[model samples]
Target chain A: MVRSKFFVSLISSLGIIALSVAWMPVPDAAAADPNTFNRLMKPPSKRNPPPTQDGIHDPGSIGTQGLQTPREAFKPLPPAQSGNYVDWVKAFDAKKIQPRFDSKDPKAKPVIMDLTIVRQVKGSMPDVIFPHKQHTEWLDCSNCHPVPFVPQKGANQMSMASIMLGESCGVCHGKVAFPVADCRRCHTETKGKATKTSAKAAAKPAKSKKK
Target chain B: MQATIHITKLRLLPVAMLLLVGSAAVRAEFGDIVLNNVSEQQGMRPVIFQHWFHRIRFQCRVCHNELKFEMRVGATQVTMDQISQGRFCGACHNGEIAWTVENCDLCHTGKPGLTTKIQGGHETKGPGIW
Candidate 1:
């Protein structure tokens, strides 16, 4: 009878151990293909993979061989901590990459707007400083206006939760531009101690051209 | 001896269950979308659309506005017939702007038996309670 009781306890303990192991948070790499996991959390070695190996293009395709690898292309660009590890804003400012403003008309120049929008957030987190100069360098105003963001200030209500759900700034920030992991990049303004640049920008009213 | 054998069999149950749960935890990275609306039925792999690559070349307005691609996944019924006629993907993929659709494997690179879904990285929601 004692042997049977010992076996029951052993089986129960083993079951508990198994349950705990199963419930333990699996590492992101273990859950999926490391290469195909979230790019934001990718190790430095896997950040800028080749065209064929990046999982976007077919490895067997002949065209994949001809395409340039991100590592080679981003060598001269400003380095970053996440995503493709290329600081696109710095690269644009430094003239390392001049993205065409208009796809159809190569000669068309972007209507550069030097503006900034400061969003005050609750809690100890720093306020957000949305810079139009950096964004307009590569994108047109229509890319964001009237869609994810309204032209007028305070017209759109935004929150971290909505952004995570792929709304508002998240439409691009976490997808094409940069992942939200780089929080300090946007939330740069401290409470009651606004930087000179942001303070000057906040003074000017947002100018929106009606179509 | 009999109790020992029974204990081993019972222990195997949780081990098997753990494996089952682990296999179900499939996930995808940010900007990756698995488009398999009609691929598997036609003996083709689902297309893995990478938003990062295309956005690097053209602005969001180019595809979202000019191409009229809905923001939601699987919202646009992209068909080969529409593509060949210079609509949707064919606008730039018609041998002049970008690669022609003749090379099928380039776009359709997703694993077999997957469905249309955005493989968005959930971690982008930021840490802690919002």
Candidate 2:
């Protein structure tokens, strides 16, 4: 009778210990039953693993103001911050251009193309003036000529939507080259332009064909 | 079950078509080159050449002009035997300048045997194993 009483006490003690353990901060149970157990109980080491060499470190943990930091709060380059409208253009022009050497043809002279393309994109924005001379000075003509933007005008329909989706001008612009955020850089002319209405006129034929 | 299978196939069709269209419109990015000749048959991943890494150090004309690397993919026939004998990619990657063929993962990108340095289990003393 005494042994039986001792056995009952031992079982009760084990039950109480198990209940206490369950009630206590159990990280394993927290992972298994996240809804019931608090996630804070998870060990710091397991919750936040040490960043691998190749893996990008968390910006929030690195003391950077997480997502709320304004881009304009940071100081831009001197040329970018300049009040003068033609500061970047003037600066680019002022710099002495280097001649590109071709290994295949030693005598090949660098062909400097100075042409301007004025594309009218309806009322969404002003006409985009593309300066060929500026781009050609840095890059080869083959970089964009035959493929992305055909040499022939009206061959390709370049829209703002397409550019935003990394097509045509977007292949270089907003990537390796200067970004498309600076409005005044491309759209220099603030004056109202005459409308050709060629986009609508071109669309009518396709629409009629579909009908 | 038949209806579910049909619906799944119908859902998959657009994704497959998009993949096809996406692959068809492959423009030459700075560091993107797909080389798949004998690699797939020999149980190896195709080589993905990084043009950007090479271009930063050397001009475009250096490889295209001097090395005679063809413009199109699979235009130049480069064998492992030829490579070891100082031909094609081996011109620079002959252990003297760039990383040799023993470091397969550098060109192979992601592969099953990426952990080990030498490829195909056994290392060939000479080009006789080709």
Model 2 lDDT tens row, B1-130: 6555545555555455545543332322222345656665667655645433453334443455456664334567777788888777777787766669886645654222222111211111111111
For candidate 1, the lDDT comes to: 0.66
- Kindly give the stretch of ten consecutive residues in candidate 1 chain B with the minimal lDDT sum: B121-130
Tens-digit lDDT string for candidate 2 (A1-211): 5455555555655565555455333445346765764454423232211221101212223211221211222112123421111123333345322222343353465456866666665655656666675665445666566767799988988765666555676554443334456565665433343244443343343234323
- The lowest-lDDT stretch of 10 consecutive residues in candidate 2 chain A is A48-57
Candidate DockQ scores, in order: 0.27, 0.04
The count of backbone overlaps in candidate 2 is 0
lDDT of 2 at B11: 52
Kindly provide the TM-score of model 2 when superposed on the true structure, using C-alpha atoms. Answer: 0.37
Runs with alpha carbons beyond 4 Å of true place in candidate 2: A1-110, A137-139, A164-167, A170-211, B1-41, B45-52, B58-105, B111-130
DockQ metric, candidate 2: 0.04
| Top candidate when judged by TM-score against the true structure | 1
